[model samples]
Each structure stands twice: as C-alpha cells, then as structure tokens.
Target: MYAIVEIAGQQFKVAKDQRVFVNRLASEEGQEVSFDNVLLIGDGDNVTLGAPAIDGAQVSAKVLKHLKGDKVIVFKKKRRKGYRVKNGHRQSLTEIVIEGITASGAKKAAPKKETKKADAPKAKKATGKADDLKKIEGAGPKAAEAMVNAGLDTFAKVADAKPEELSKILSEASSRLAHIVTETWPKQAKLAAEGKWDELKELQDRLDGGIEK
Candidate 1:
C-alpha cells in the first residue's frame, strides 16, 4: 500500500519501508512520528481519497537521521542601481523510513474519548501544561504546530521567545508562514502566561488581530 501524506509542510507519496528525505522535523532520531494528513491511500486498484485529508487515517514513520541538502546559490542584482548580492543556502532535512499505514477507522485519539467525564480536570491540566498556542493571536494551526514542534509549546516559553528566533523557525518550516508577523507575539504570550485575559484581549483588539502594522 502507498499513501500521500504531508510531513513538516510538504507532501509526498510514501510506501512501507521506503526511505524519504523531507524538511527537518523535530522528532528525535529513531523516534516514530505519525502524520494524519493522508490525502489518499491506494492498495492495488482500490483507491480512497479525502476532501482535504482522510479522517482516522494515519501514516507512521521512524526518523532515521537529519542532514543537509545540497547547497544552492542565490543571486540577485539590480541593474543600473549597482546592487548585487550572492549567497548560498543548504536546506536542513530529515531521513525517515515509512513503517506502516493505517487506513480507515484507526483513529489515534480514540482512546482519549473514553474519559469524557474528566473534562474538567483535563482543562486544568491543559492550562498548567503546554498551552494551546491557538489562543495567541496571529497563531493558527500550522503556525502553532511549528512552534510546538520546535519545543516552544508553553505560554511562558513563547513569551520569552525572540522574534528573530521565531522568524527563523517559521522560515525554515515553510515559506507560507513567512507572511505571519510575530512582532507582538511575545507580549501577547506574556499576558496569556500571566493569566491576564483582559489585557491580552485589549492588546489583541488594539493591535487589530495582534499583528504588526
């Protein structure tokens, strides 16, 4: 069987035991990482597709190692303006081998629903642990995932994160996240960490979505 799955920010067609290189991920070497963004799965002539991503479908792989891709030169010039710039960049990448693919009805979060009655405790636990980054303005699912994967999963950590550092992380993850401005994220994260909900709300409103103007 083979499946098209998204890893980091790019998608690839992967099959069992196949080794693939992708943008660097935060998973440790030898650790198993699973992707739920299965676009389609195929086994022989039978094919299953998803509107965006298949529900309950997961692809798990073990990270083999991390390395750098071949360096490429970037050249830019402004004619008549006498402006010329040249640089070289090497992409960070990770090598992973597909372990298995679980098609339909193999939800990973299925066990978490058994204790539905413990929602109250879970809420408190969540509030004290790795906070939901989505609460911070300017952070959506993809952006938040990038942050969490980089180990800045808590409000306090995010509050202390420098804008330049955060920018580098986002840049390395995907060019799509390049447009996301994080100038005010630390300040907003600080308020959230301190439980200053009112102040955070005020700042987000004043900043007009908590993005740099």
Candidate 2:
C-alpha cells in the first residue's frame, strides 16, 4: 500500500520499493526503520486521509545506504576590506527504500515507480512574453509568472497585498520565489523597510469589503 509519511519534518508520499533521501540517521545500511507517523494510507480502490495523523498506522522502510550529498562551497568576502573566507560542506543523507505500509484502513500491493530514461531530457514550458512583466518596477518575467499563478496579475494587486496573505498564497512556492520576495523585490523591500505591508493589506481588505478608505 502507499502512504503519506513525514520524515525529518518533511512530508512525502511513499510506496513500497521506492528509494528516498532523508536527513541523516544513525541506522546502519540495510537496517530497517519503521515510522509510525503515517498521515494517510491508500489501497487500490480505497484511500484514507488522517486527521493530522493516523492511529496504529506505520510505514516500514529499509535503509539502503548512507552517503554525503555533493559538496557545497561557501564563500564570503568584504569588498576592498581584504577579508575573505571560504568553506565547504556536504550534507549527510540516508537513502531508504519503502518496504510496506500497515493500517486498519486497507491493504494494497505497491506498484513499481516509472523511471525516466537518462537520454530523454524533460522539456521546459514557456512562461509568457518577457516584455509583459519586465515593465513592473520589481518583478521580472519569472516573478510575474509566479505572481500570476498566485492570483496577482497586476501591479495594483501587488501593492495591495498583505504580507501574511501573500505568505499564505505562496506557501507552496519554491525557495527561489521566497528569496526573490524577501530579498529582491524592490517595492516589497520598501514596504518592509517602512513596515507598512500589514497596514496596506488591512486597507485593501477593507476596501474590498466596501468600507470607505
């Protein structure tokens, strides 16, 4: 059976024989780790979603290997200050294969995951015309695409966005989008500098409610 499980504070849908990389643990290779935090369980014809988590449910996995990820080089410098620092780090990881899922809900054998051929590269989808988004003060074409997906297609919409509202809308965003909004967006930076996004959002919400500004 397939199950949704949490590992190292991250949620993942896992099925039997599927290999997954998770945070480093002290288990030896070929050892077994059974997580009792199954969130959901699914069979061939039935699916069960947990209320936060399922009781008496577990997902067992076998540790295949312990390895380090690719090395990352960190460099820091102060321009014209004659100060520089360099460091390298590799994240420890554990690769585990899902073995079985057990619960009172249902039972189903896991299906083999489809593997993509190495020779066939995935195609990239075009976002939109770059010029359409480049005109915004702080948004580029990629950022505009992200905004559009988040239901903000106009500059006025961005200007009226509340920080918490924006955060909720972009909760599924990649780290790149988070970094762009937190570190790169000029108007957002200005609003953050003035600490006015919350107030702005409140005003926008009131306006939408037909309250006079």
Candidate 3:
C-alpha cells in the first residue's frame, strides 16, 4: 500500500513500515506521533485521492532517533571580482519508523481539564483572584499560579504592577518565565484595571494575527 501524506508542512508519499527522515519535532527519541493529512491512499488496484485532504485516514509513526542531516555546502563566487563565500548547513531531522495507517482517522478531542478527586487533600485555591476578574486572557496556568503566590492575584493589581515590582517579586521564584511576565503581564493588568476588555481582546488578536472580533 502507498499513501500521500503531509509532515511538518511538507508532503511525501509513504508506505507502511517505511523509514523516513523529517524535520525535527519536539519528541524524544523512541516516541510516537500521528499524522492525519493523508491526502491519498492506494492498495493493490484501488486508489483514493482527496479533494484537498483525505477524510478518515490516518498515519502513525515512531521516532527512532533525532539526527542532523548531511551537510549541504553553499559556495558563492563573483568570478570577475575575486569574491567568494562558502557555507555549510545541516538540517535537524527526526528518523521515523512508520507504524501503521488507518482509514478511519482519529477525531480531534477537547483538551483535558484538571480533575477534582475527593479523599485527596483539598487543593489550595489559587491566590491570584482579582475583583471583577473573569480570566487572565493570555496567562498560562503556571504563570497565573506564580502571580497568585506573589500576592498579585487580580487583574487590577496586575495592570498597575510596575515592571520593577514584578521583577523583584518573581525574581525570587524562577527565571524561566520571568520575561513573559515582564512582557505580557503589564498589558493584561492594564486592560483589567481600565475594564477595557474589548480593547484588550483587540490587542491580543492583533498580536496573534487573528481576524477582527
């Protein structure tokens, strides 16, 4: 059997158990990932092609290793000027072992939420609660939690938060996501402070390149 599929925004024809090198993905060696952009499938004498993408078809693969591809030498020269430039490039790659193909593709599912379980110790409520706060629009859960721990729970507090204040507080926590707080936290706080929710949404859409609300 042979199938046409898309991987990492590029398309190729593949078959079951085939080995292929693709652009590196965020997977550890020996991990697995699935691809659904099976554009066409053929077995024996029967073949099917999608108008754009094949519906209800899937391909799965396992990463055998992460590797750097063969070096590509680039040389540029201006014959009359005696100028030459040479460079070598190595593309990051993942070596994959095709697992199997399924005609019925996997359905997209909603992301899982934190589950509440009785008998377990009651989880501490997040500290970053602000008056009139609905959601911190661009904040991730851990970042929000850090803000709560710092006693700046509400959007109102965040909006008026001086860069120096946040730097001082979060600097003691962890430096990994510190830059994000400096960049996105102040803007989010301002929106919350002024109750300019729509304006904040507009700014987010602009930054994210989304169509107008």
Candidate number achieving the greatest TM-score relative to the actual structure: 1
Please report the TM-score between candidate 2 and the true structure. 0.45
Best by lDDT: 1
Q: Tens digit of lDDT per residue, candidate 1, span 1-213?
A: 999987766889999999999876655699988888799999999999988888889999999997778979889999999999986656667899999999976656434465553543422223346789899887898888788767788889889999777776786666556435577889989999999999988887655323433
For candidate 3, the TM-score is 0.49
C-alpha lDDT (0 to 100) for residue 88 of candidate 2: 64
Query: How do the residues 1-213 of candidate 3 rate in per-residue lDDT, one tens digit apiece?
Result: 888887764677888899998765545688888877788889889898887777778889998996777879889999899999986656666789888887664675465355632333222434334443335543566556666666676776777787557654554444333323244557756886788889887676544211112
Candidate 1 residue 157 Cα shift, in angstroms, is: 7.0
Query: Which ranges in model 2 have alpha carbons more than 4 Å from their true place?
Result: 77-83, 105-213
Per-model TM-score versus the true fold: 0.57, 0.45, 0.49
TM-score of model 1 vs. true structure = 0.57
What range of 10 consecutive residues in model 3 has the weakest lDDT sum?
204-213
* Model 2 poorest 10 in a row by lDDT: 175-184
Q: How close to the true structure is residue 95 of candidate 3, measured as C-alpha lDDT?
A: 88
* Candidate 3 Cα errors over 4 Å, as ranges: 78-82, 109-213
lDDT of 2 by residue, 1-213 (tens): 789987744678999889899755445688977776678888988888888778778888898986778879889999999999986656566799998888854333365345532332321222442124334333456556665666555445555666445433333343233312211233543443466758545543433111122
Clashes of 1: 0
Q: Which wins on lDDT, candidate 1 or candidate 2?
A: 1
